[model samples]
Target: MIKVGITGQAGFMGNHLFNYLGTKSNDIELISYERDFFKNEKTLEAFVSSCDVIVHIAAMNRHEDPQVIYNTNVGLVNQLIDACEKTSSSPKIIFSSSTQEDQDNLYGKSKRDGRKALEKWAIESNGEVVSFIIPNVFGPFGKPFYNSVIATFCHQVVSGEEPNIHSDGTVNLIYVNELSAAFYSEIISNKNKSTIKMIPFTSTKKVSEILNLITSFKVDYIENGVVPNVSRDSFELNLFNTFTSFIPKKHFPKKYIKHEDDRGAFVEIMRALTSGQSSYSTTVPGITRGNHYHTRKIERFAVISGKASIKWRKINTDEVFEFILDGKEPAYVDMPIWFTHNITNIGDEELITLFWINEPYDQEDSDTYFEEV
Candidate 1:
């Protein structure tokens, strides 16, 4: 197995990449990294010597003084190089640069200079370096104000705060999961050459266009409890998923309205503007139904009969969210991407659940990963 470590394992992109790599434990052994390591030479050297590959992702993105950003970023690159040289380590280094390298700003200049320094170190130490010029990245769990504009907008919309657009210029974007997969592929490729690769943007949109789309999701999904028309593999679908991730955990287990008549009672299980497949299952008491999660598909579990407890825990996290539902008061809980979830029959009678997903199951590319909640 390849031993890989990430410098900024706690940052937005770093955390996503770290967790994505965690899913491939059979092939890659992740080396733990803490921010404090950079302050200590011995610890940093130990980290450098232990890794087969190191991804340098930690950098100061914003500060009141632009020079501080430049100094901090370049200083990080220097420290990493120093640690490598001190330990006589030649581990392959994957550097994360930004598209802002061409802009007339300190952040851009820092990325440019940092990449050049790494390139110099690779040449002198006979080490491998892959410097990626990445575009704007967005995804779930991103910091509202610090990560990206998309994250800020999603948070604002979800929290009932009005979104403001400073500029309507077009933006090239890549989802965090997509970028993580690219990084993983590179780590496994084992190419023993130093090179610079441009990570292409997967989607492009005007600032206004993105805001409008997210606002529409707030109206449809958040307010009306209706899933908007979204197709699998579409950028809209990814954006919708990102928007939903910002929702407060307390908003879930949404109760459905039940209509009662002389004969019986009826309740709508789901309302969507897209096509999907619906299935139901009967689970015996004391049995659990699911311990899997989907990466792209939107799924929901509605308790139609008996009492059930649904649990969810995002990958690489200890916090687990749970909701209880009964047949008498119909309710549903939607599963978010990258979260392992399960439903248990907590009652005496058989548990009946109605399942709805945005797409039909395909064995060839199910996108399902099994994990305990």
Candidate 2:
């Protein structure tokens, strides 16, 4: 079992690392780092001893003062090394450095100095170290004004304000989950290779390109109810998911553009560009709609009437995820690729569901796989 400890458990990168580690069913435990990590020697030593691997992610990147950044970061390294030295068994360390570390700037210098300190400690203790020079990581729940420029753009767009692109420089981004995946790789591979570090990147795009993509995603996917061709760009799918997750809940299930007359009204719920079809299913009380899986087909269920309990279970897994939806609160849940799923009418009345598939359903090639939930 791997006992891992993360420095910035509440911060963006640290939170993502925490979540990713939690998902893996491998025998791994998260070592708790106390709040007064620097001040309390007993807590620091105990925590350091408990961890088999330590991930240092807590560093001040936004401070204006160079000295503050330098002092805080280097001091963090000092405390960590001191704690580790007190323990007989030294743990492998993963330092979260930055691409800016090579630049001639204060933040860069601070990160560079911090990495040097870690390198020195690793040499002295004969411990392993892998300092990842991470790029800008963007994802959901990031602070609007502080954490990421993507968050700023998404917030501005959702707030109906003009997105401000102060700089046109290209920005590299890795979804936080992707970053976590990289870290998990390091954890699973306990080989000692600390001499020289290698930098990795997941994706990169121009600032204008990313901003424009998000804006289009909001318009086409959210407003016009178009399921995007996520196959076109995988990273863009992550960006779209992050942008949509930031949209205010009150603006969800946005009112459709209605064509009205004296008799009735016609509202187009959604329209896909190349393929896909909309489906409707009505389930009475004590009845279920689906107990199946899909290999390539992507589906979404929006409960437009009554109530439902949508459930998903990964192939050959015992765990099942359940999501409740009702017409009173309009929302949609997308199905997983290989996960078997179903929707049950939990309310007293009939359950009405609207389904969207990525491709037009064919009687001959439905692409649907069934499994009992």
**Candidate 1 lDDT:** 0.94
Residue 168 accuracy (lDDT) in model 2: 95
Q: After superposition, how far is residue 208 of candidate 1 from its true place, in Å?
A: 0.6
Worst lDDT 10-window in candidate 1:
158-167
Model 2 scores a C-alpha lDDT of: 0.77
* Per-residue lDDT over 49-72 for candidate 2, one digit per residue giving the tens place of the 0 to 100 score: 999999899888777677888888
CA RMSD of all predictions: 1.3, 6.3
- Cα deviation at 152, candidate 2, in Å, is 1.6
Tens-place lDDT digits, model 1, residues 1-373: 9999999999999998998888788999999999999999999999999999999999999999999999999999999999999999999999999999999999999999999999999999999999999999998888988999999999998888998888799999999989999999889986799999999999999999999999999999989899999998888999999999999889889999999999999898899999999999999999998898877889999998999999999987899999999988989999998899999999999989999999999998888889999
TM for candidate 2 is: 0.77
Q: Relative to the true structure, how large is the alpha-carbon lDDT of every model? A: 0.94, 0.77
Model 2: per-residue Cα lDDT at residue 14: 86
